[model samples]
Target chain A: DQQVKQNSPSLSVQEGRISILNCDYTNSMFDYFLWYKKYPAEGPTFLISISSIKDKNEDGRFTVFLNKSAKHLSLHIVPSQPGDSAVYFCAASNRANAGKSTFGDGTTLTVKP
Target chain B: DVKVTQSSRYLVKRTGEKVFLECVQDMDHENMFWYRQDPGLGLRLIYFSYDVKMKEKGDIPEGYSVSREKKERFSLILESASTNQTSMYLCASSSLGRVWGETQYFGPGTRLLVL
Candidate 1:
């Protein structure tokens, strides 16, 4: 079973606009959510993260909003740049569980110039 | 900066051959993990070790084994590689945490091709 899911396989947005990537989870036990950005042939780098207690977390141009009630979360990049184009993965983990994270299928975001 | 290095960026092996993938972390992390990424399937954990000599099976550990003889290195072993095992393998390491979940740093990944 896929505990975490990224319904959208890919997304496209024009440069200088906003890009939003969505993710959902079935497991309520997950209290921590993290987002990672990956480029071709490179490992994923940490972007932003939010705890279950918080509704949103921001890091520079990247912002992650979490809605526990809806069991959903979204990553927003304002003024998206062409360099932002890459695969984004959403992951969640329950503190009680030895920090084993469940990952979504990932969404490929393309920021057009 | 914390760096996770995988032994190889690409590898090719014949079916039924024994294969080994090595990972080394310079961050002095106590936790190390191995995962395989396949198209459409996402990243599935193969194995993890929280401490030297201690290992745990993750979501998918079949046909795989892990060894952590040193704190900074973790090795994944494939007894007999199969074609289905061809995929990108990633290694990650994180520090042990209490209430907060630490972020895992990953290597560039090793693409394994078993023909």
Candidate 2:
């Protein structure tokens, strides 16, 4: 069973516009969530993360919002740039399963300049 | 910064051949994992090691085995190369902490093709 799911396979946006990526999970035990960005032929790099206790986390131009009641989380990029184009993966893990994370299928984001 | 390194960036092997993919971490992490990425399937864990000489099977460990000989190195072994086993393999390591979920550092990944 796929615990974490990214329903959208791909997304296209114009530069300077807002880009939003969504993810949902079925496992309620998951207390921590993470986001990773990957480029072609490269491994995924950590983007931002949120705890179950928090509703939002922001870093620079990126923001992550978590709604525990809905079991959904989203990543938002303000003023999206072409360089931000990449595949984004959403992962969930809890303290009991530290180090082992359940990852979504990933959503490919393309930003047009 | 944590650094994870894999032995190969790409590999090709014929059916029935034995293969080994090596990984090393510089941060002395206690937890290490091996995962395979496939199209539309996301990343599936093959094995995980929490300490030297210790390992646990992951979601898809049917054709794979793992070795953790030291604190810094974790290896993935393919007993018999098969076409279905070809995929991008990733290695990651994370330190233990009081926090709920520690961030994992990943290697560049090794793409293996079996014929």
lDDT of 2 by residue, A3-102 (tens): 9999999999999999999999999999999999999888889999999999999999999999999999999999899999999999999889756888
TM-score, model 2, chain B versus true chain B: 0.98
Worst 10 residues of 2 chain B by lDDT: B95-104
Which pairs of residues collide in model 2?
A: none
- Per-model TM-score, in order, reads 0.98, 0.98
The regions of model 2 sitting more than 4 angstroms off are: none
Clashing pairs for predicted structure model 1, backbone only = none
Give model 1's TM-score versus the native structure: 0.98
State each model's C-alpha RMSD to the native: 0.8, 0.8
Give the lDDT of residue B27 in candidate 2.
91
Per-residue lDDT for B50-105 in model 1, tens only? Answer: 99999999999999999999999999999999999999999999887557676889
Question: Cα deviation of B101 in candidate 1 (Å)?
Answer: 1.2
